[model samples]
Target: MGKNFTYLLGMLITIIIGTILYFNLCSDCIAGSSNNEVEQVVTEQATAPEPEPTSYPFAIANGDFDYSAEDNFNFDLSSANLRLPVSEKVDFGIYKLKDYLAENAGKVINITGLYSSKEANNTAFPNLGLARANDVKNYLVKLGIPSSQTNTFGQLKDELLPLDGVLLGPVNFNLADKAEDESETIAALLEKIKTNPLIVYFETGEASINLSAEQRQKVADISQYLDKVDGAKCLVIGHTDNTGSRATNISLAKDRADFVKSYLVRNGILENTIESSSKGPDSPIATNDTEEGRALNRRVEVTLN
Candidate 1:
C-alpha cells in the first residue's frame, strides 16, 4: 500500500511539470511573433516616402529693378509725373514706369492717382485723377499686360491722415473728355497762380517763348491752368529795359506780350480773358542800366484776376 501511494504522487508531479513547460513555450512563441511584427512595422515606416517642399511662381516678379517704398509697397509715380508743374502736354515719366510694369507683367497691379484739395480744388480734379490712372493703364496695356489685370483709382481729395503733402500745396492734372465743359472756379484758378506763378522770360530781341524740352514744361504748366479756368481773366504784361530805342523797345514788349497771349489761346486759354499790355522801360523793378536788371525786366508776367 505504501509503494502504490508514492508512485501515484510521482506521476502527479511529472504531469504538473509538463503542463507548466507547455504554457511557457507557447508564451515565448507568441512574444517572438509580436516582436517580429513590431520590427516589420518600423522598417516600413523608415522607408516611407516624404512630402515635397513648397514653391512660388513669382520668384522673379520684381525683375532686375530696385524699388523703395516711402509708405507701404505702393510704387509712387508722383516723383516722375505729379510733383512738377504740368501743362496741357507735359513730360509724364512713362518710360521708367513701363520698365517696371513689363517686369511684373503676370501680376495684377493697382494704381492710385493721388490729388490734393488745396492744390486742385476745381471740378477738374476728378477728371485729372481719372486721366492719370488711364494713362498708367494704357501704358501697361501697351506693354502686353492685359487691361483687366490693372485696377486704377483716382482720388481728387487726398485721404491721407496727418496731411502728407509733397512739394508744397496741391498738384493738379486734367484730361477733359468734352470741349465745352467749364470745370474750374475763379477762386481755384487765382489760388493756383498765387501759389505757383507762371512767368515767361524772353531773350534779347526775341519775342517768342522758348519751346525747348525744359521750357515746354513751363509753358504747359501755365496752359493747363488757363485751360481749366474758364472765363478766367489774366493780365499778360510785358516789360523791357531802357536799352534800345524807346519805340523799338515798346514794339518788342508789345510783341512779346502778344506772343504769350497767342500761345495761351492756342493752348486752350480763352482769347477775350487775356489782356496783352506792354510796360516798356516804365515798370522797372530793378535798375535798367545793368544786364541783370535788363534780364529781369525782359519778362512776361501772367496774373489771374
Candidate 2:
C-alpha cells in the first residue's frame, strides 16, 4: 500500500510541474504579442501624414520689400478696412496732402475737413478755399501735373479761416475801400493815376508807395473790389523812359502798358474797357541820365473809359 501511495505522489508532482510550465508559456506569449503590437503602431506612425503650415494672400515679406509696421503675423489682416493695402494714406506731414494733390494735377479728388491755423502742426495750412485750391493747383503743376487740366473746387468753403489774420499776420490794406470787382478797380486805380491821385511807378517809380506785400495786396484787394463795383471798367496805360528813341520807346511803352492790360484780360477782366496806350519815353517822371531815373521813367498810366 505504501509503494502505491508514493507512486501516486510522484505523478501528482509531475502534473503540478506541467501546469506551472503551461501558465509561464501562456503569460510570456501574451507579453510577446503586446511587443509585436508596438511594432504595428510604430509602422503606422512612420507612414502618417504631416500638418501643413499657414499661408498668405500676397507675397509676404521675404526681405525684398520692407514693411511699415512691425509684426504682421500678430494681427488679423483678413479685413480690408483694417489693413492698408496701398501707400495712399501714408504721410510724413500735412504738406504731403498738398504735394499729393499737386502731383495728381487735374484729377478730381475729394478734399474735406477744416484745417485750423494756430493748431501748431496745421497752422501753416491755407485758410481760404480758393487760395488753398490755387496753391494746390500750383503745387501740382510743379509736381509735373499738366497745368491745363488742373482745376480745383472746394467742397467746404465756409470752414476755412482768413490767412491774413493768423499766418499772414494782420492785413494792412483796406480790402473794403477797394472796389469789389478786379476789372472795375483796376480801371478806377488806373484812372486815378491819370489825375496823379494814385501814384504809379516801375521798380522805383515816382509812386511813393513801396512795392511791398502791403502795397501789392492792396492792389489785389482793390482789383477784387473793382470786380464787385457797379459801372466798373478797367483802363490801362503804357509809359516808357525818355532814354530810348521816341518811336521805339513809345512802341515799347505801349507794349509795357498792354502787358498789364493783358494780365487782367486773361484773368476774366474785360479787354474793351482796358485800353492800351504807350507814352514814348517822352513822359519823364525822373531824369533819364541815371539808371534809377530811367527805371522811374518806365510807367503805365490807366484811365476810366
Candidate 3:
C-alpha cells in the first residue's frame, strides 16, 4: 500500500511541472508579438510625410461670369506700382472680363486697392492705395474699357502677407449697375467740377507737362461729361505770377493756355470744343508774395460751360 501511494504522488508532481513550463513559454511568445506590433506602428508614425502649404488663387467673378488663375497682378513692397502677369491664362481671363463689361453697359466696376500703413506714399496722390487703384484703372482704360464705367478707391489694411516681397492680387473688383437718374448724375458731376476745378501747375521754366493721377482722373471725368452733353464747351484759362514784365507774363500765360488746349485735343477732345485764354497776372488764386503762393498762381484752370 505504501509503494502505490508514492507512485501516484510522483506522477501528480510531474504533471504540475509540465503545465507550468508550457504556460511560461506561451507568455514569452505573446509578449514578443505585442512588441513587434508596437514597433511597426511607431515606425509608420515617425516616417509619415508632412502636408504641403495651402494656395490662394486670384479670381474675378460676376453674376454668371467667373474666372480664376494661379497668378494675377503683383506689386513690390511699399510700391504703388504693379504689373500684369505674363501668363496666357491671365490675359485670357482679363479679356473675358472686358467682354463681359462691354455686354453689360450699365455695369460699373469698382476697383478697391489695398495698402498697409507701413507703406510709403511716393505717388502724387492722396495715398498709395488710391494711386494703385488709379494705375489699375488706367490699365483697363488703355485696354478699351470706358473710364466712366470704372471707379477707383483705396482700402487700408492692418496686415498683408506677401510672397518674396510682392503683393499678389492687391486689388479687388466689384461690379454694380448704375441705378441713379442720368440727369441727376450729370448735375452732380458738374457741381463736383465747379467745386473742385482741375488745375495744372507749371514749373518755372518747364515746358513739358505731366499730369498727376488725380489730374488724369479729372480729365477722364470731363471727357465723359462732354460726351454726354451736346454743345458743352471746356474753358482752359492760364494765369501767371508777377515775376517778369507785364508783356512777358501775358505772353507766357497765353502759351500755357494754348499748351493746355493742345493737351485736351490730344486726349480725344476736339479743338473747336475747347476755348483757351490767358488771364496773365490779372487773376491770381494765391498771393504772389511767397514762392508757394506764386507756385499756386502759376497754374491753368479747367472749367466746363
Candidate 4:
C-alpha cells in the first residue's frame, strides 16, 4: 500500500508541474502576438501620407478696384489765369479736379501738362508745362493733401494739331500704395516743398509782400508745419529776376528775405530757428528774356531743416 501511494503522489506532482508549464508558455506566446500587433499599428501610422496644405490668394496693396485717370476732369489751356481756384470763375475744370482729389485723398494724382505748340514765340513749353502742373500741385498741397500723393508730367507737342493751342490733359487720378522706402519718402517731401514754394513776391523794385491768396496759403502751411514739429528750423532764401544790376538785385533779395523772416515770426514761428539768405538773379530758375519767365524767376524758397 505504501509503495502504491508513493507512485500515485509522484504522478500527481508531475501532472501539476506540466499544467503550470503549459499555462506559462501560452501566456508568453499571447504576449508576443500582442506586441507584434502593436508594432504593426505603429509602423502603419509612421508610413501614412499627410494631408496637403491649403493655399490662399495674394493680397493687392491698393485694394481690388481698378483705378485710372478716367475718373478726373481736364483743364482748359486757353485761359491765361494761373491763380488758385476761387471766385475767379475762370474754368470749372480745376475746381472739379480739386473736388475729386479732396474726396479721394487715398488716390494718387498725376497732373500732366500738355502744350499744343512748341513755337519759340509761345512761352517756353517746358517751363509753361512745369508751371501749370506746379500750380495745380501747389493748390492741392495748400488744401492739406500730402505732396507724396501727387506727381507732375510735362508733354510738349510732338505734332501740332490744326488750330490747337496749349491744352492740359485730364489730371490722372489712381489708387497707389504709400511709398515704402526712406529714400522715396524723402524724395516726395523734397518735391512737395519745391512744387509749392513760398514765393514772397514784391513790386517791380520793392520789398513788399505780394499779399495774394497764394502767399497767404504758403504762410499758413509754414506756420502749420512749424507748429507740428518742435525745434525745426527753416532757411528762407530770396531770389530775383535779372531785371536790375547785380548789386541792386542782391540788395533787393536781402530785403525780400528779411520781409519773409519777419512774416514767419509774425505768424508765430520762432525767430531764432529761421535763417535768411539771398541769391538775387544769379539763381534765376527761368529765362530773363521773357516777362513770364522773369516773373517765375523772382521768388523765395523756404527750406525746412
Give the winner by lDDT.
3
Q: Report the lDDT tens digits of candidate 4 across residue range 1-305.
A: 99999999999999999999999999999999999999999999999986432211111123544322211223345432243333223133344445655667565656554444543312211334443454555555655555556655555654423223423232233345434563465555445655777666565756555445555545444543443344656779989998869999888888888888886664434577689999989998889899988888788777776
Model 2 TM: 0.34
C-alpha lDDT (0 to 100) for residue 234 of candidate 3: 85
Worst 10 contiguous positions by lDDT, candidate 4: 52-61
- Error in Å for residue 39 of model 1: 62
Candidate 1's C-alpha runs over 4 A off are 1-189, 192-196, 211-231
What is the full ranking by TM-score, best candidate first? 3, 1, 4, 2
- Every candidate's lDDT: 0.53, 0.43, 0.76, 0.56
Residues 1-305 of candidate 1 have per-residue lDDT tens digits of: 99999999999999999999999998999999999999999999999975432211111113454332222111122421333232211122333434555555444455555444444322211233443444444444544544434445556654422223233212222211222222344355467666655678888656555444434444334444543454556778888888878888888888889998887655434476689999877887788778998898888877766
lDDT of 2 by residue, 79-161 (tens): 10112222232222223433543554333332222223333211111223323343333333344433333333323322223
Shift in Å, residue 157, candidate 4: 50
Better of 1 and 3 by lDDT: 3
Candidate 3 is scored at a TM of 0.58
The root-mean-square deviation over C-alpha atoms between each candidate and the true structure, in angstroms, is 22.2, 26.1, 13.8, 23.6
Better of 2 and 3 by lDDT: 3
Report the Cα lDDT for candidate 1: 0.53
Question: Mind sharing the TM-score for model 1?
Answer: 0.36
Question: How does each model score on TM-score?
Answer: 0.36, 0.34, 0.58, 0.36
Model 3 per-residue lDDT at 281: 92
